[model samples]
Target: MVELQSGYKLKKLRSDRGGEYTSAEFLQFCEEIGLERQLTVAYSPQQNGVAERKNRTIVEMSKTMMKEKKLPYKFWGEAVNTAVYIRDRCPTKALEKVSPFEAFSGRKSGVKHLKVFGSICFCHVPNQLRSKLEDAAVKCIFVGYGKCEKGYRVYNLQTNKITTSRSVIFDENSLWDRDTQTVDSVTVQIRSEDTSRSSEEEHEETMIDIPSPPQVLAHAKCAAHIADTELYG
Candidate 1:
């Protein structure tokens, strides 16, 4: 992207000594673009005060959120990402009650869509995706907001997969206490009406039996499972 103020082309790149910036492909790209580079000394965070402070704030917020929700260390990445998302939409000390999101986008962001991190949710399984005898919704953990779509990012407990879905019913009021032994899953028999479904259904549903999350660390799976998904998914 070109500079918006003077409309001048980018000429230089100043950054810390990170592996991402020093990669061969990135170096080649910068070279091809004739972008001069000034790399800061290793472990010198003071050279970039704004970014350093922001990173620190995100880390603190993530840690607080994880501990508050009783989520394990394995879900740290998701907590960090969600903390950033929440922070961007919140008022900053540097601004006059303006959020970073509004400062850049030139408009206020919608706050209604925001949900509690690691809350239990029910993702609607479309009629086409399931048979009449099959369940209508799947129980999942609300991890984060969707990146590329207008939806939520959820971790399916039964299928052991991540999915982005607009048709999700969140249960923010219900929280799990870390006391019971870890189990595979629990059954949640929810009595529902036609309006209970996210994607409004024509026919009424008697019961929406979905697998409830076990009373473990809120959204934490085994280290290998959740960490990879939080990083790559």
Candidate 2:
């Protein structure tokens, strides 16, 4: 499909001596299509430097992304897919600042719609899928871009499933690890209600306390020290 779209023909295929590529059916297909097969010697990766380096780059990128987000190992596939999607749009030195996607498609790739991978987001839920009082959006994690659709790939935490959707609101500043904030908010609300009742019960007591002048100065000094430490460190 890519070759057809790019108006290019596969003249030669260079790869290691893998069994799948060396099979009789494969050779016959290659011969029928007039494609030359170039096999590298055993244990000689240098002979296929381009492919080896590309594979290394992809794996490293995927590992870095997964590590940065602290994502589970099961999501490695998604990370690899995202890495390839980004790599296609990124400019290469050999291409003189032109991206691989642009070189192949004869058009520049647009990255305006790209979102931060592993960022916390809210995917819009269809009205028919929920009740009127239920939440309209469900929390999810941004994973990658859809290949055949104009949408983003997100992992629905609630459903333990991955889905592609265009109507997602990304909170790039947040991460999946911080999802506990929702529960913490509810806990805080409950504590606040208890505290309010206690305060109302204690309102009858005439007790007052105020910081001394020296205490106020000490608090100001502490704040200034913290600011200076943060600024310099």
Candidate 3:
């Protein structure tokens, strides 16, 4: 509205048949402001060439970013936001070295806070929920910015959900190794089983064997009879 008021007297406003711009409230406001409302036909988005082209450009950029980073499909929103953010500040042929941000804001925008998308971030865990034995933070994937809050959208590893968190430490140089300890665990289990079986076999061989009770009684009686014979003689 400010841009419209600044540029012209707001004689007419044109848009597609989207629910956002074609609501009754918007029509009433336009009527009150002496502005003519022009809406394109239903299912005819091509009539709005500039908007459609911009949308296509942003979509392509987002796809390129996702492909380059090998990011998951669920992170499309983040990738798109990052693409738009970068595109806005980047110099374009039409702008002649002037960025969209500088053109809109009349000043250069700072790019210091930008970080690589899908990077590892450790978000601080709240003290109330963390146990003494647990770590002080949780690892997460940096997705994008928060739409409603003043923070970044981070996918929490523990919760398996996206959340806005301001407290995060980015590990840009780190990448997750999928099978770092896979072979070591299997080797350790095999060695432990082999050791256990060897010990069991050794114990079985060291067991002592004993004679039956009837053999012992016969030997004792024979010794007693010999003593009696000697005494009689």
Scored by TM-score, the top model is 2
TM-score of 2: 0.74
- Comparison by TM-score, 2 against 3, better one: 2
Q: Residues 142-220, candidate 3: write the lDDT tens digits.
A: 7777767878888876678999888776654333333451111101111123455655454333322332222333443
Assess candidate 2 and give its lDDT: 0.76
Model 2 residue runs over 4 Å out of place are: 178-233
Order candidates by lDDT, high to low: 2, 1, 3
lDDT of 1 by residue, 59-114 (tens): 99989877766767878888888999999999877888899888876789989999
Report every candidate's CA lDDT. Answer: 0.74, 0.76, 0.67
**Candidate scoring better on lDDT of 1 and 2:** 2
Q: Lowest summed-lDDT stretch of 10 residues in model 1?
A: 215-224
* C-alpha RMSD for every candidate: 13.4, 17.9, 26.8
| C-alpha TM-scores of all predictions | 0.69, 0.74, 0.58
Off by over 4 Å in 1: 1-11, 176-233
The TM-score between candidate 3 and the true structure equals 0.58
